[model samples]
Target: MSISATEGVGPSLWGLGATTSAKTQQDKDMFLQLLVAQLRYQDPMNPTDSSQFLAQSAQFTSLEKMEEVAAQTAAMVQAQLAFGASSLVGTTVTYATGPAGDDGSPAPTATGVVDGVTFGSQGPVLSIDGTDVALAALHTVTRPGIGPDAGTAAATPADD
Candidate 1:
């Protein structure tokens, strides 16, 4: 069935008036519907300017491309975090821990080999010596023999 914009029927079919703002895909579709209806029912003697229609179409295309770029940037950030974490595997990392004394004091450090990496709500977390350490918590990365117990022989957990 044909529709007319001036009959109040177009708003009901589109769920939103053409004059309303659109922020999402559904809203964009409704906006497009309203625009189409307006074009179809516009006064034939005073038709909309072709340039105006072209401008609106250009704006919509720009908005769509911006959304695509945002999505791709987010994916790229996640991939970078994953790659950085993965590279830490088998390497010893030292991270800050609480004070060595009961009273507030200088922070101590713990060292361990990264066993695995996993994503958490905040960001990537590294599995170090059976403990999950946030990436931000790491203070330094060094060879296995360079930390606090550099010369002490310790049993490897994997050997147990």
Candidate 2:
């Protein structure tokens, strides 16, 4: 009789944890538990191959490193968003008011200089003329004193 390393493990092993850091720790713990159980219950007459164990260990290490890189990348992206939002503090921005009218009219828009930025779970919200506007709603950014055509900077949506 033989039991594979992943004989009973299923899709539940890939379920997400509460946070990136917490998820990584949880994954390591679960992997270790499975490895220990495999070692303890193996048939003595047909011992599991040592090379198989080594391969599993190497795969676990690779997964851990990949998780660390993902966490670092998320942090870097957040920092970039903060810096970009801050740079817009004094620039005029034209933003959509809402969806287009049901009568086929274009969507209403409002323009204002961004006065402040507030970070939330959804990303940065710009305070434009005292109104809170999502970064995605912005259409164009223009320097305060420049003409509309010459100063218009294309708006880019933030990644969700």
TM-score of each: 0.62, 0.72
The 10 consecutive residues of candidate 1 with the worst lDDT sum are 13-22
Put down candidate 1 lDDT per residue, 22-99, tens digits, no spaces.
456465666677778778888999999999999988987687567667767987998899899889988989987654
lDDT of each: 0.77, 0.84
Give model 1's TM-score versus the native structure: 0.62
Which portions of model 2 miss their true places by more than 4 Å? Answer: 1-26, 101-105, 145-160
Global CA lDDT computed for model 1? 0.77
Among all candidates shown, the one with the greatest TM-score: 2
On lDDT, the candidate that comes out on top is: 2
Error of 1 at 114 (Å): 1.0
